[model samples]
Target: MEFKKFKLIKQMQSTIKKEFIFLLFAAVITSSCRKIFNLPKEKEYLSNNVNFANKILEPVLGRTNLIGGFNGDNSTQPIHFEIVNARYGDGRPVTDIFQKAQTYVWTAAYTGTEKSLAEIEAKRHLEEHPLFEIRSSGEFIMWPSATNDLVTPRPADSTNYPQDTRFFDVKITNTGGERLIRDFQIRPWRERPYDPADDMNLYTGGPAPFPETPYNVLSRNYIRPSRMDNVVGDSTDIDLGNDNYHRNNVLVYIRPFTGGNGHSLRFKVLNKDSVAIDPALFNETEWVRLVHGFNLVKTKEYVQYDVAYPIPLVNLSTIYAPGGSNAYIELKYSRTGFGQQRVTTVLGLNFGIYRAGDWEIVFHFRKDNPRFKDE
Candidate 1:
């Protein structure tokens, strides 16, 4: 019995010794961890004072629009943002804004120097995403795929008023708390397909002239070696009687021409009688480097090119676009007058087309045929 008692005591001592060693090892590890890497305590900044500016968001359909109205105030970094309760102006729920959509995202870098449509398209990949999204950084993005069916546009007339609008609430949250900006107005506008857009009211879709640089087409006459007293400074300056050049004399129209596969662009100039003008007369035009197009075909009637859609593949200055924003088309011809003075008439237009299609731009000189003969 004494020996058994002594054995029990020995077993207890062994267990206690092992437990003490384990405790010591744990303590050493804990102390070393603190000494090796010291980290500051996480901060929780309350967003109670965080607010958004009272501004109406007007996103245009068929284009990507960025929303700006966030005022961080005293909010901390990494605040989360979400669109809550999206609805029409009449309080009807808007389910389309949250639905998944196939959106084109750039998979590879675009330097605006892509040689082919294949090269440009290969850099992009389509992925499913929401039509509208708000980032954690308070940046709101309305995807390009947002159409008229997805959201209501501003009414064009008083009869349609009070019915055409969209509304939503923004929810922002942080570790401190959450905030809701109530009844934020969203007045979406109809799609304006191309940039350098015509003067059109976004709310009413009515004719509204731009205050400055009203038109996109800049057509002017260039007179070299100084102008004579008898010679008119501009084509529009003097009345050519039947051949007068008015601001609206030339009518430019874009129509779909499905001749060159899917992506193609063609230019056609027509006289007052609707007869096709020889494109070769524009001698100063660089046929080879006219645009980012390949497989150029020139004829007496029209100039066709196998081009990548959107004229400029990207929104950067390249040989294709000198301004980096709009596609510029220049047509030029020079003729010597009575005094052997050189008169160069250069017609230029700065414009943009976003939709992908086989398209043709026709310039119709409505009043009279351009004088190409020397006096």
Candidate 2:
């Protein structure tokens, strides 16, 4: 009886061990299957590539305004300037309009040093006779007469207007020889009462303000791209008319008048017309079809680094403009000072335009400073 009981107990123990082994094997197989089947999130994986494109393209084509307008008074009309064309050395058009607009703003804000013709000639002769090249082309003709008499406080009420200030109608044509036209309405800087505490200052406040003037500089028009129909792609058939392509993600560094200080800046990005392509379309199986249908430039990555923060992931999108399509992206950034103070120096805006494929740097500086200079 004892021998039989021992054998039975041993058999039961063997059965339990076999069941444990089977359960362990099942768990391992389940885990392995999960690992094989799990797919990565699409947007996350592609987001890095998108960001890489932005970093590469932002400085090249992303930091200036294409068109901007400023109105000093509500009773009077605002002054407007448009950028007609901007391009790179390789002849490919830099399509961001915002960069062109910021360039105009920087030009308007510049204040040049006054000198006699003899002094100018002396400096020109001494300063290595800089090659005279029209960095940009087309007409920058001023609109509206410079001597238009507008509303102002009476002389007895205010001694501000010693003489009627001039307003010039200006146009900038063929910016950088890309065959485009930019127009501007230039006027003398008029000083009006400005209170920092006023809510109306956000739009048309100081230096020139109406009763509605607020505490800050009133923004006349938000920077934007042109809606003209002809702006399509890189094709020659699109008639590169007086209308120019605009982009707004280029960064500029400029020197201020009073502080002798410099600031780094970028414009805002507003409108983009390209669709984000899915990465799945580039599957190996679809390679033959992709090659047959689209002119596929192997997907490249663009990246950018933020100057502030713990350095989080900065994502950016790339719009593919077919050979002849008007392709552009806009990005806006305010000026930053060393101490984080918003410097009121208006003249410190600068812009550089470059191509996306090439890694070159194109710097566009203001030729003349309108506000401080009498010329």
lDDT per model vs. reference: 0.69, 0.24
Per-model TM-score on C-alpha atoms: 0.72, 0.15
* Tens digits of per-residue lDDT for model 1, 112-168: 667776887899888887888887778777877777776556676533444455678
Output the lDDT of residue 317, model 2: 20
lDDT at 88, model 2: 35
In model 2, the number of clashes is 73
Clashing residue pair totals per candidate (backbone < 3 A): 0, 73
lDDT tens digits by residue: candidate 2, 213-321: 3334552212112222222222222322223312222112211122211211112111122222232321222232211111233332211111111000011121211
Model 2 segments more than 4 A misplaced: 1-221, 227-375
> Whose lDDT is greatest here?
1
